[model samples]
Target: MSSSKAGSSLLDGSGGIQPISEPKAGPRYIYYRIYTKQGALESNNPIYSNDRFISRIVSRSVAPPHTAACLKKHIFRIEKFELSTKCTLYSSLSDQAPVEDSARLALRGISGPGVSEIDPVVLVVDVSDAKKRSKVTSVEAKDLVEWSPTRRYVYYRVYDEAGEISSKTAFDDTDSCLGRVGTLCISPPYTALSLKYCIMGAEGVSPDRVCNLFEDEGGENTMKDGDTVALLSDNYPGVSKEEPLAIVYALQKDPVNPSEQSNFTKKLIVTVYGTWGDYDHTWHTTKAGEIFHTDGILLKKPYVTDSEFACYAAINSSGKKAFIHQVYSSFG
Candidate 1:
């Protein structure tokens, strides 16, 4: 008859959700509290409405925020749009499973009301009737692209996948062609290289989720870093002038302040490339300390819906998830 037990009955019967991770035992000592806001207006002081981390009150109609769309997208902020860096982080408990996340991860990157749209809209969701509130109307995440004291534009490429985009073999083999360019407009530029590969899903419903490259395409081994492939939607821009399988363009983000800069991305697409399928990508993160992701394993095309690489790490475990995407310089 404790609070967790009582709250458990109301929301999905799971009341004891822990924070992403516990504080580690080390010299870096700093204590902080987490506060959640339902209808905009966040206060600097952490607000625990019920006033307790260990409450038994169930999530009465309260819904959680989408993970990736919130914090991952705003990995960096800058003063200029075109001169900005965009990023997304994904991890899965298993290469063959869903991403892991935590309570803090759930509340990672939330901006004020109408202001949410101006944000990149990364971890997005339709959470209505969220916890004690009636009729919660839609939620989108935003990250602050603040400028550091330095004038350098912020950029991150911690999770770049290096390989064929897909291997489903559904597109007319003719469409499988792509090119690889490295080190475009950036300072201290070198060969920021990661092989790019792409393939389409099989031509049918439930076509093995697109990431099951070799198995779906009847190959003994999975496609490797240098192989070229195509997907069902690879023909939008014509066939591959570079490789065997066709390729799709990577997702693009407008300068939060386009008036300032005009940078863009060219990574190949993992989902059905190019049409309106871009919005389908979403993410989930794990509690802190859970290994962010294993190193050196790039999931070129791993049968994921919407191409949003999903990452899952256990709270406090390193290398929990196993996906990697590298960053490099490219030329037009």
Candidate 2:
């Protein structure tokens, strides 16, 4: 090669082409301001006459193209500003057309060389409906109150079985009880099941175990699972620590299998303690003079009657069917 000048070489000693360095570019940004008003747009008064200035927003130039709706939502999220359902954004005080949600900011001359820190694009919002909503929300918050009910306490006693209280000896003897006497604090509208659970917890018994609750110590006037505690107290008043309500552990009977139940039929010899006849003529009647015999009796179905007690359907000895009041007959 010809004699190469010391400073004329374009390549380095590695035989690779040398690259030229360029100057670094500065960061770019879009700047804008927001203003809000709480009334209808007026041409004579002008939107910027008495408008309130919100925070100024600065966005990077490299960000994706933004629409009016997108920018409004972003401002709402960043500023935690609430807007009403019916509101609109305007580019200038004199602008007759509102900025559409899909309209691009760049296309609308909101962001470009014309926009600057001193002469930034201004966004105006009409929040007349928003003011109404805010007022309503404030009033509702001021009127809100917490719900609280008065607490009441009730005392109860537990027995091993119904027979224990039936003889009245268990009521007089503390040693005859299944557990020590317990008290329950109840609020109105409490259910009987909830009371049972409280008693079960006090007696240290399993929750799955069944317990029968009565309003009286004699175990009469049974309390159903759905009965309200307030109603039960109304029916039987004057329950105190000296005379507490009675609770008995129900005897657990083995469940009859469906297959065995299908192959077998049960017949009960019921004795009528009083003379009763079905006034509705839907079923037969029973006379106290004769011992009524039935082939099969359906006791599960609830018969609607004026009597306070429940009624059951039974087939009489003469093959006649009738509904019998539960209190008039004794099943053997």
Highest-scoring model, TM-score: 2
Give the poorly placed runs of model 1, Cα more than 4 Å off. 1-101, 106-202, 208-221, 224-241, 246-332
Each candidate: what lDDT?
Answer: 0.23, 0.44
Among all windows of 10 consecutive residues in model 2, the one with the lowest summed lDDT is 38-47
Clashes of 1: 68
TM-scores of the models, in the order given: 0.17, 0.26
* Prediction 1 global C-alpha lDDT: 0.23
The true-versus-predicted C-alpha distance at residue 185 of model 2, in Å, is: 4.7
Best by lDDT: 2
Q: lDDT for model 2, on a 0 to 1 scale? A: 0.44
Please identify model 2 stretches exceeding 4 Å from their true place.
1-152, 162-188, 231-238, 253-332
Error of 2 at 36 (Å): 51
- Report the error of model 1 at residue 275, Å: 26
lDDT of 1 by residue, 1-332 (tens): 78768787565556755446755432211111111111111212212332211111111112345343333222211111111222222221011121343323333222221122111112111112122223221222222232222121111111113434422332336433222111111101010111121112112112112232221212344433223222212331122322222232323333132122222122211221121112112122222122222222333434233344432211112211123222211112
